[model samples]
Target: MGEVTGEVIVITSGKGGVGKTTTTANIGTGLAKLGKRVVLVDTDIGLRNLDVVLGLENRIVYNVVDVVEGTCKLKQALIKDKRAEGLCLLPAAQTRDKSAVTPEQMAEVAKELKAEFDYVIMDSPAGIEQGFKNAIAGADRGIIVTTPEMSAVRDADRIIGLLEANEMQDLKLVVNRIRSDMVERGDMMSAEDVVEVLGINLIGVVPDDEKIVIATNNGEPLAGDESLAGQAYINICHRILGEDVPYLDLRKKKGFLAKLFGKN
Candidate 1:
């Protein structure tokens, strides 16, 4: 529940539109639900959505840029989540780009947050650039989020290579937006395939659920819902804590004879 120095974990993806921000939000919230002091930093400056997803956009008088510029202390910029205790968000500045902050500044912020929180979870902007570098600079652990599509998997491979070059230990993978029906029909790559292709330990796999879109639009994380996606994220938190959680069977169930054959 308390730590003198916390672990910094970056949730990143090489391509956009792969649910990186949403994963970060839910993972941070899920950890907070377990009574861990968690802080989610939005490193996607200019195109900030973490605040919106957490429903704290109007509460943001200051941002990460302000913290980096010394205009406001880190504590002053954090927006506490009313939905979960021990959870806070350091939002990105909508007016600034990734260049607004440097890798060293990000490390400094992480160090400061570590003293107060048990986990410093960063939501890195999609791609391998200054923003991604800044996001990973302070992290002792990294989680790469990717879908099972070919493009996503290819980008994830490149990101993993980059993470290795950065000497980031404890790197893991989270396959997001998996389609059960497609997998059952052999129309899409399975989670196991993604793990094999990426060559990293699979931390979690989120099923494709329509509720996630509604949750994001309503400014609530899908993890609070009882849907498959929600439970997947909760399981992700447990895995982050080093728990040996079982993966959910999200494949579609067919006729008795079809079920006899089992999923593809």
Candidate 2:
């Protein structure tokens, strides 16, 4: 109920197809569900997809570039979410590349948003390019998302190094698309393994569920749903809020996540 002075957190994955944008949407939605004023900023530039994932693609009259380029006000560019109160999205410019916005501009925008919101979540694009730098420019903290793959973990480590080099050391890790069956069968890396390899604080482990794909297709984030993935995202949000929510025990049988968190 008090004035919401937000913390800017960047959700990034150095490699593509690692669920970074999904993480941003779900985290923003989860915080809003918990009654926090949240803004999801898509810094992906040319390949903007956060708007689509949050079901706000049709409502984007202006984008982050527009706001930065002085073509529109920041308030005018923000597309409010219909499903969650106090939640809005500052979409990326699909027509422009990452070079369209500078890191200074992003930092300025983040500062302005932080003064107005409880949480400002930025979705960084794939690769350690100008887009990635722009995304993390004004972040108070960083969430590095990676799957249970060696390549993903490697890229995550590289991103961590970059963040540390820039003096942003408050970083956490989220291992996504984890398959319990594969881990049990020794076919895939466990979340613990990924965390160990990355050598960072493990915030959450999201199970690989078809529900995530369905939710994305429906332009709905799974963070507030009843699915395992949804619970995982909620747990991540709680952790981000400095809560001590326990991680889901995915080492059980195939349906263990469902049984523990209730039916999907």
Local accuracy by lDDT, each model = 0.91, 0.92
Clash count for each candidate, listed in order shown: 0, 0
lDDT of 1 by residue, 1-264 (tens): 245688999999999999999999899888998889999999999999999888778898999999999999889999999988999999999998999999999999998999899999999999899999999999999999999999999999999999999998799999998998899789999999999888899999999888888888988886645888889999999999999999998864478987788683
Best lDDT goes to which candidate? 2
lDDT of 2: 0.92
Per-residue lDDT of model 2, residues 1-264, tens digit only: 247578999999899999999999999999999889999999999999999999888998999999998999999999889899989999999999999999999999999999999899999999998999999999999999999988889999999999999999799999999989899899999998987788899999999888889999999998967788899999999999999998887653447777789754
Once fitted onto the true fold, the runs of candidate 2 whose alpha carbons sit more than 4 angstroms away are 1-4, 251-264
In model 1, the runs with Cα more than 4 Å from the true position are 1-3, 252-264
